[model samples]
Target: MHWHDEIETELQQMKRELKRSTNWNLDHSSDPNIEGLENVLKKLNHLTGLQGVKNEVNTLINFLKIQQLRQKKGLNVMSLTLHSVFCGSPGTGKTTVARMMGEIYRELGILSKGHLVETDRSGLVAGYLGQTAIKVDRLVESALDGVLFIDEAYALAPEGSGNDFGQEAIDTLLKRMEDYRDRLVVIVAGYSNEMSRFINTNPGLQSRFNKYFYFEDYQPEELVSIFEGICQQNDFKLLKESRKHLLAKFSELYIHRDDKFGNGRLVRNIFDQVIEKQANRLVKLPRVDRDKMMVILAEDIPD
Candidate 1:
């Protein structure tokens, strides 16, 4: 069994034992949800690379908890703006982190529902004037009481375009943000430079999005770790030589990476390709054992 599956089984057993114990009479109705929240944190922490991102999230959670305590004690509490900017390249865990933030917010009683609504330029912008506002409104309405994660948000404000509907979408989105300030959180993400420019496009965006989390690209070793974790989760084991090949492959990929590098997505794609190769090799074999089926050899590694 997987490590996580074993942990989950143990957790369930403990919960059952606690329920049966009369000495532990504390209310346990919310224990499952609390466990779920902790699980989310565990998953966040276990993500490969992004140490800086993890630290930022922890600091933000701590600050919010302290602010809540102050508010409960009738002390002056500073205004909180949960909306944020996530600047990162593709597949750097921006969307994944956004989804987790929603769950965290819901658990902390900051949002009515912990859900994520993801969109891009095409989801918000319309071809005609006045229609963009309507589209944005519907999207925002669906995202109310949750998080609206806008990927490639910079496209909402194209440069040197005086007659585009992108600006209209942005304006409408900003207005809705104001209207639902207490109920909605907006997270805009894109390439670091482009996201900075997008936030600068409007003063409101500048004021509202004070928190910024920058996700750095995964290092070569981190990429290998991620790939290995994927394999382990899928019940695949790598041969001794396959590990070396993966390390070298990831190192080369990191060295030649451009802005278009897909990071974790690239690793996943490679895994898919390698598994296909494994399948082909297994089918051609006259006889194959369970070990052979589960093991990925160096020969299966893509060139």
Candidate 2:
């Protein structure tokens, strides 16, 4: 099995160590508790710059609602495919949206647990023969009654490969998905083109994952707003000059962005650097106060 260099071996080890662990990417404790469907939708609407995603999710919710009404009236209801394909680049809110989808699904009476279990090729494929199946089986079992999110899912079917164990993991996962059709949901995510290729890798994948959601990269203003939100959450205040610098920097970044451009992730990294620079400036002062600690100057905003 070919492992992406970016996915550290420690991550693979964690998957084995925490085979029974729940909630891979999203933290339920920090998020607002889902008391009802309205609250769940409110949270979805709060996410930045995903108008298309928000609309599509609303469409699904309405469809499910009508399906429930039809069933109540004893009308024949069409079968629902809980599986989906999330196409996007890194840090474009694919994982966050997937978590919300799980909650929405639960509220609609589609899933039982609605928790999200995340994995990738490294989490499923093993070094030896016959081991991939076991790994996939354990992962699927843990994800029962919930959503199984496979990030960078295209890696499982590497181009021009033979005898790769990733295919075995894919086969096992497909079987488990069917066996738990009523109780489980699966979402495979990656770059748009690669995800399309992944779905076409197997007829089963194409059939089950007919639903697709495309997440566009955040615009310059959206990135700045995301940065501001992060600052508010962290108790940092950006001055007018700092905000101006940020807008220009984000605009430049957006203009020259490539397919692999990190949208929200780039903003987050800039935030980290800004905070570190602010701390360095404060350390040079004779004395510091709460105001100085909270303020982020123009110089703190990196070029």
Candidate 3:
């Protein structure tokens, strides 16, 4: 056989081996569960903010559903690459959304396991030579049939660092991504600018991750709503004055936001502080009533 024919035969064999190992049966038809899909959609919609992200995810779900329909019809279907880049700042719900996406994809029969394995630079890269690849490979193995979420992925390639082993981890990751392209999805998330630079570091990275989700900072109203949700979840209620004060505080925080400003995280912190203060105040009460025990007063708001 010619060299081209030999290569083709090897490729076909590899494909068959991969199919058997993954137990992927393209002919097997599993009816789409509408209730499951709706539950996933409802979860996505219930998130505090990220209207744009919600819309993008809806579009992706629709596309995947169409692809499934095409496969049932025995029509030619193009491969769908679910790997993505999430660009946002701290506390922007990147990780939260990645987890949601994993469940959504799994429900759509795209991934066998919808679990998310979250890591960062320190998790993948090793201190010594030749170890980074091994470390990354282990992570990839664990993340198979699931999603590998690399937070602050830009740190993998530090700028102007000549001796960093991050490149080795990246190389290992890229290879495994190709080997398990059908069963695994990798999401790299970081600050918008830094993530862009990280992607530009490797030419192949851009092509592999065609979908980009940019999570915008939460607005003041959304932040307030998040705080309210937290309060309700924890069996706490904000007094009318406390609610007004919190709204103002959130607005002020949003207006004077810095690069490190935590969106949902900020609200959570404030909520915790208020709860602590409320407890402190309750301890001083001669006789704490049920309503007073659950109510957060304006004085509980931290300065």
Candidate 4:
């Protein structure tokens, strides 16, 4: 059994932990009703790097804490204006961070309920004009009191004056944002330049989204740490040579990440690929020996 497998094995040991429980305490006077949101932030805070981004999240989290206290005191919650523009090269962890934001807001009282409804152009809009509104409304309903994260928001701002359904989707989304100001946090994500254009395309959109955090490409040392961290997380022991090779591979990928995909997006595919290769190699090992199986050799990585 590998360490990565341990995650599943542990979950199996207690199905309830993997699944949220409906057993609310019978006492209505119980204290502190956070729904595992703070627990998630604790884990994220421990991850290395992203100091600047981490600080930004901490500030918002504090604001959320204030809102929670106000709700407990039966006071009106303050309106939120911390929508962000995540700019960076591929594989830098944008989506993962967004998910964490959802959990944080859930912990906070800014949202009546906090969750993330993820989608892109195809996911939000329809082929016809009027149809787009219905599609968008459903998305809004699903994201009620949470976040509706639209990735590649720039696609809505296509070149040359055309009535692509993209514009319809944007229009519907904008109207809903205003209508549902009491609930729902909308986040538009994509390349920095494209995201800027996306905002400028609509004045309403521009005025509302105020926070912007750029995710930089991982440095060589950062890549090494990321690679080693992945190995350790999955309970794979990389030989010193394999560790250097993995680092170099990821560093090369990060260097060329500028063509289109950013760091947060690109690095994950490499992780998945390595895991697949390692798993296949392990499968053929005459017997499943959890102990003797130690090192991942350099040959595990492609030339």
Question: Residue by residue across 163-253, what tens digits does model 2's lDDT show?
Answer: 7999999899888876766667899999999999989989989888999999999999999999999999999998998999999999999
lDDT by residue for model 3 (123-212), tens? 999999999999999999999888999999999999998768999999889999878777788999999999999999998798788789
The local distance difference test score of model 2 is: 0.86
Name the lDDT of candidate 3.
Answer: 0.86
**Candidate closest to the true structure, highest TM-score:** 3
Question: Candidates 2 and 4: which is better by lDDT?
Answer: 2
TM-score for every candidate vs. truth?
A: 0.87, 0.87, 0.90, 0.75
lDDT of 4: 0.70
Off by over 4 Å in 4: 1-38, 63-80, 261-265, 271-294
Give the total clashing residue pairs for model 1: 0
Give the better candidate number (3 or 4) by TM-score.
3
**Can you list the residue pairs that collide in candidate 2?**
none
Candidate 1 backbone collisions, by pair: none
Candidate 2 error regions (>4 Å): 1-35
Enumerate clash totals for all models, in the order shown: 0, 0, 0, 13
lDDT string, candidate 4, 1-303, tens digits: 999899988878676432211111111112334766568778777665677778888787676566556656877555557567776545667777887787676565445566788888888878875998899999999998788888877877776747688888888888887676667678888777778877888887877787887766667677667666776777878778887887777777656755475443344566667667777787888886875355677767765
Rank by TM-score (best first): 3, 2, 1, 4
